[model samples]
Target chain A: MTLLESRSRTSRSSHGGTAEDSRPGDLCLVVMETPNAPHSEAQAAVSDPPADLSHRLSVLLESIGRGDQAAFAEFYQLTSRRVFGMARRVLIDPELSEDTTQEVFLQVWQNASKFDPKAGSPLSWLMTISHRRAVDRVRSSQSSTDREAKYGASTQDIDHDSVADQVGSRLEAEAVVRCLETLTETQQESVRLAYYGGLTYREVAERLNAAVPTIKSRIRDGLIRLKTCLGVS
Target chain B: MTETNSGRNGRSGSFGDTVAVDLASGRAVDLAELYALDALTDEERQAIEQYMSAAPAAERTEFFDRVRQARETLARTFRIEEQPPADLFDRIVAQLPVQGSGPDAGTPAPPASGHIAGGQFAPRQPASGQPAGAQPAGGDELAQARQRREERRRPGGTRRWLAGVAAAAAIALGGVGVGSYVADQNDPMNQVVRAGDLREASVDVAGGGTATLLISSSEDAAVVKMNGVPAPPAGKVYQMWLIPKDGSAPVSQGLMDEEALSKPAVVEGISSAAALGITVEPAGGSQSPTLPTVAAAPLGA
Candidate 1:
């Protein structure tokens, strides 16, 4: 489905399409395929970026930590819309989302130096912060039900093809979805519990009644399968 | 970290240690690297960090590759589009106080001085200088000029020429020494009589809450009127230290309390400190600080 349709659905659920309809921007879709979309695997045949996107983010963060305002602006220009979207997804109010955006940026300014590339990807770092901040806001404002409803609805359309279609066009998330499909039913379920459900590996293991090591290995194997199947560099 | 040469594998009965020989489909797969990249629980992450940190030297290469590949895929999987808010950098810099201020504030270059609080800075004898007297006039003179310029800038160039004059004087008298270095060395008004060595110190509280330390040396042991830190709490005072950063234990200079000296209290051993620190300690200062948050006034910062 297009981003427009998703926003329309979100609009139906809460703010009634007001914010969605008002924006004159391109409804800018990165437009990769959804995991369930037709012809999902075909997008993987075309290779695009040679390096992982995290490295680029790491460099941007390093310059930002050095107090480079121009770099900070550029980082924001590229990242703000997505962050705003995620914030809006979790926090229904535009004003609150904007406030979260401001706080997220302030955090970025304060903690940029802590972004060590060795630990993990910039996306994870940013997402973790965004999610935590969003969660904090939800809890603080006593708006858990409203926030979760919007979150649950928007994420309902999680297709294997969409990641490919949205973030990058070249080699879609087809391989990841396909590799994920190849896992044993239990392993696949475990991977899902950990990934989409945001459960830790230990929690995944506990829920599956499997040993922690098994859960760990299963998730890792699942990802490796996705990496190889997707032909991701 | 203190675990055995090899981890005492506790998974004997654990699922990981089970011997399930897949005879029918005899293919073994290793997934340690893959699991780490997936953001496992803290325990799992700790296990991996231990395994990787202590992995046999030979296995490191393969391990790193798997880790890197996993990180790449995951990095690509999620992306963040967040940016810093406006003018944050300016605010961060603004929060940082200026390097020099307070009583011991005029010396050029940073020298060994008893550590004082409230970011009071001591001037070091310029690499080339006539000691005890270097035209103290230039020191505060330049400071006042700087303030005037700053004041002028405050109104957004309201007093443009005055600010300009101050700026010009600052440029002329900075460490670059546009004027004669020796010209003011002999002037008594410019020289602080080396009181030899400070005997003791006391925190002298002032009207505006700024606490000054009166440090008296022996006869003529450079009496340094270290000032500027506002008086700390009564129950908890700012304890002084002649902190040596050479990795050695600290030496106590003195504590700043209300009952201390009202004027510049003399302190012995005031000139050998590599760095000075003020920590909030018990009423009667402790051997070590209870809270030593160095409000660092960097030497020459």
Candidate 2:
């Protein structure tokens, strides 16, 4: 089983508070809470107000820039899963994704001073770094063969259902799913394939059998629509 | 929109042909969405960057603001949080420079001190007369070329490598002379370092310092450079082995003493090696890697 599956299972069992010691109502409570409980402390933090979370991350980054290990650790705890999940989504190989995630955090620690809060939100900065690193790993020569095999094995549409299954519990993620539903089929596919598949616009166009300009405009239009729906400006 | 396009066209015509058309058609502004989505290739991104660089400061700020918002919105869609493996943080910690020993510790060093030329280890030359963090002649150009090449090979890899080297140099060199000691073209280490597909990884030694392994897949060789690493125990020496990916026997690369450790050790025939492992061995070396390696840097093949 995946580490996430094992973790959720452990969390479920722990929430049970000893099966033999629990009453039926307690069991029912555990059952009801299972789907709602944040998977970890980090996930719990995700429910914080977006502005507060972003501010906290920016503060942590400034501390980390001064070589604060504790701040670095806290930052890692708050952001690692998102970083790793993005890497895993793009790279598909857990080992490589893990390596990329490690590299991303190391970069965070070393170059936290480069984080310009004026340019973007802390989460956006972090995810930008994460996404670029993951895409680079996928495009690197070392993984080319693996990528070829992956491409051969799976040319189908992105499994949004599976993506939703993984992220469905989070409020922001649910809103994102709702917003994604507002996109046209082509726009959604183009954006998803380019962003998550780590495919370039040209590659996305090729994958969908569309023109490059069409794919580019679709991705751009789709993101614009998402920006509107998500109220990000 | 037409007025905006005509004004942009007057300025963008001098930038370049593709960029001129992109701006004239008002697609350059729309390309911000593609840029934010990372759907554009390097060339396309550069085109957009050129267009933005030519625009008025206020316009440029507005464009980037839009891009940032778009990226932020898209980033929120990736909410599937899977906990990274428990040991990953520890691994990152191990690579971090010790507190107060990093480049930011009250030193006004060049920001570029983080970058080390490929295969060019910081040669410990106290008498070389180059001050710590001094930029060599044409260093900026070389660094930019290296950065571009690195981005072409693997985006974001150069930054991470720079970070590693910065941390490693800070700890291993004690924050002194972190500038690249560029060797002449005739140097064998230079040849491998200059390879198009050069890659590197560094690991902390058991006692102190760091050992960096620079791998060139195109050259089928790797150069192992040791900095501030203590010599092996009396009657013992450090030996290198190529640990095969197939789970076969470790192949001996060579041995290094105090003097040899100061220089780069070029290990050829690393195409099949999963990692370069170093172990403490009797002076001449051992047939196989001794249990518990002193240091090992994965080739990431």
**Model 2 TM-score?**
0.50
Count of backbone collisions in candidate 1:
42
**How would you encode candidate 2's per-residue C-alpha lDDT over A109-205 as one tens digit per residue?**
8889999988888989989888888877787734434654574444452332222332223455577778889888888877877777777777776
TM-score of chain A of each: 0.53, 0.72
Candidate 2 residue B80 Cα shift, in angstroms, is 2.4
Q: What does each candidate score in C-alpha RMSD?
A: 24.2, 18.5
Give candidate 1 regions above 4 Å deviation: A1-47, A50-59, A80-186, A209-214, B1-39, B78-301
Q: Give Cα distance to truth, residue A143, candidate 1, Å.
A: 17
Q: Kindly list the per-residue Cα lDDT of model 1 for residues B1-301, writing each as its tens digit.
A: 1112121233222124211221112111233433433434344445555665666665555566666566555544443222122222223323322223343221111212222233322222223331121223344353344334444443422122111211111111222111122323342211222122212211212222222222332332212233334456668765656555465776775665643422233233544444345567777788975543322111100
**How would you encode candidate 2's per-residue C-alpha lDDT over B1-301 as one tens digit per residue?**
1111222334332222243456666556666777777766677778779888998887788789879988798777765444454346656766776444544332222222332223333322113323221222223343334334433664423232332222211111111111223444444455565576555455556665557666778888876777558888999999988999899999988788776776666788888988788899998989988888877766754
> For all the models shown, what interface RMSD does each have?
20.0, 15.8
Q: Worst lDDT window (10 residues) for model 1 chain B? A: B162-171
Model 1, residue A193: C-alpha shift (Å): 1.9
Interface RMSD of 1: 20.0
